[model samples]
Target: MTAQHAAAGQLQLNYWAEARLQRWGHIAVPLSSTRVAIHGGYGRDGKKLRRLDDVVIVSSDGTVAPTVSSTPRPKARERHGAAAVEGGFVIHGGRAGGAFGDAWRWHDDVWRELRCEGSPPAPRWSHAFVALPGDACLVCGGRGDAGDLDDDAYVLDPATQTWSRVAAPAFPVAFACSTSDGQTIAFGGGRAARFADAAWSELALDDATAAASRRLAACVCATARPGELVVAGGVPADEGEVGGVAVLRIGEDVKCVAEAPLDVMRAYPVHAAAAFSGDGVVVFGGGVPCLSFAPVFGDSVRVVMT
Candidate 1:
């Protein structure tokens, strides 16, 4: 694996060898400055299919260890959205036996269900979520029960333990990637087997992109620099299940500053995860490319330097 500096302040990714065992559909949330917490996903334990419930902590130096939580654990589910909040990490809406509207918070080695006032978004999975300013989060678009896809949006204030619906998007999307750079939240990608709308909406800017567009089912993270978003590991509409990555500068003009191919091909509806490190981003497990029944999971981690 090698890293090369790129033009436009974009970081070239160095693909490392597979460092962890194969797993996908897991959620990775930053637990502290140097640790990331990985939650449930499906993988193989021996010859049988396994739905995992263990909490694994990944250290800054690339160490993966299990954490024993003193409190109750959330249900084992995949395609969940997780983000670090004020007091802890909040995970919301994933598919277990079916879509879920329940939310849980993990803090101080404990897991607690978050019962919010008013209504929350409908039961869904594969939604896009980003940490908003002031200890809040915005969740938008996901596949609902019975194959229903939604365009709705909602905001959660962990401080108040409340949820409020925001204006829905102009077009429905799911399994899309999203990231926030303090001031703006940008989303891309859409459902599998379809091209995402060419335009993406920026919540804070109250604007959408006009010329730049690509269908992606990737994981995304913000760089240390403002107004920069990095998207990694997803299939493009034209590329089928091939893995692709890109960096977007969301400013006066929203455009892709850099683009490249992932070390391997991946598919959509795969629950991949990303977290920003000191000066780069780390992407975790995603579903391997498939053309038939059942998906082969990926066990590697890729780092993109910014």
Candidate 2:
């Protein structure tokens, strides 16, 4: 990997052959600094996935620093998972006992089960989650029981350890690859019906009833900037697989501006995970609906928006 610092405000960070990062993995954008946290997955190689838990703090000065510790994995036993820490607590989602109902909070290196007063979202994997500035955390769509897809939405509050339902938009929303727009969250993909595809939705926090809309795009991965949401490729119902990319302005129309074909054509299951890092979005490993291709792992990429 080549590391260079320029006079401009942006820091240039790239990983090369020496770092041995075979496939790009899901990324976590931290608020503390310019550092982006990354989690690496292992594919058919039988290698174990690695979580870069220690914060990698990159500064505006173009410096790369790491905070490493010997801390073990959190008390969570799930195999494939996603995690985000906010309000001084680390929240995790994963599979347990053949079900995906597991949720936990980590504090002082120990994880405690978080029980609340409402029904939890159905068991799922490869779910996308983002925490709002307030005490609420929003969980979007994911893969559900019996190899089905789910478009259900739920909210979690750290104060009461409770979950509340968020009404779906007028249109169906599923396979919701999503990210935070700093003020609210934006998601795209399709409805819950198998093989159904639909437009994207910008779920703003200001007005619960005033969700903005976009056009047809089965977005499996998307990243949010200050003013735009760059959605990556996924299979379309008729196309079978897509090589198209689209963008949705925060409150404006959704437009297809750029198109980059995937190195490999793969249909993503609802369980795929994605995150924003560096100057693009990083996607993680997931399966296809009909098991058309072998299960994918250690899959990732950075989609830079022009």
> Would you list the clashing residue pairs of candidate 2?
126-271, 174-190
lDDT per residue (tens digit) for residues 1-306 in model 2 = 232222111222122121222322223344333334433222222354433233333332335454442344433222233435562343445444344565655443344667677867776644555555454666655455566344466777766888877754343443333335443444433211111122234433222112112222233333545444544444454445543334444444333334444444332322334455556554333333236754443233445554
CA displacement after TM-score superposition, residue 75 of candidate 1 (Å): 0.6
Flag regions of model 1 displaced more than 4 Å: 1-10, 17-21, 174-181, 189-213, 265-270, 289-294
Best by TM-score: 1
Question: Which segments of model 2 are wrong by more than 4 Å?
Answer: 1-33, 39-92, 106-112, 146-151, 170-172, 177-224, 242-245, 265-272, 284-300
Query: How many angstroms is residue 234 displaced in model 2 relative to the true structure, after the best TM-score fit?
Result: 3.2
Indicate the residue-level lDDT of 105 in model 2.
Answer: 58
Q: What is the overall TM-score of model 1 with all chains considered together?
A: 0.81
- RMSD per model, one decimal: 5.4, 8.3
- Candidate 1: pairs in clash: none
Q: Model 2, 148: alpha-carbon shift in Å? A: 3.7
Which candidate leads the pack in lDDT?
1
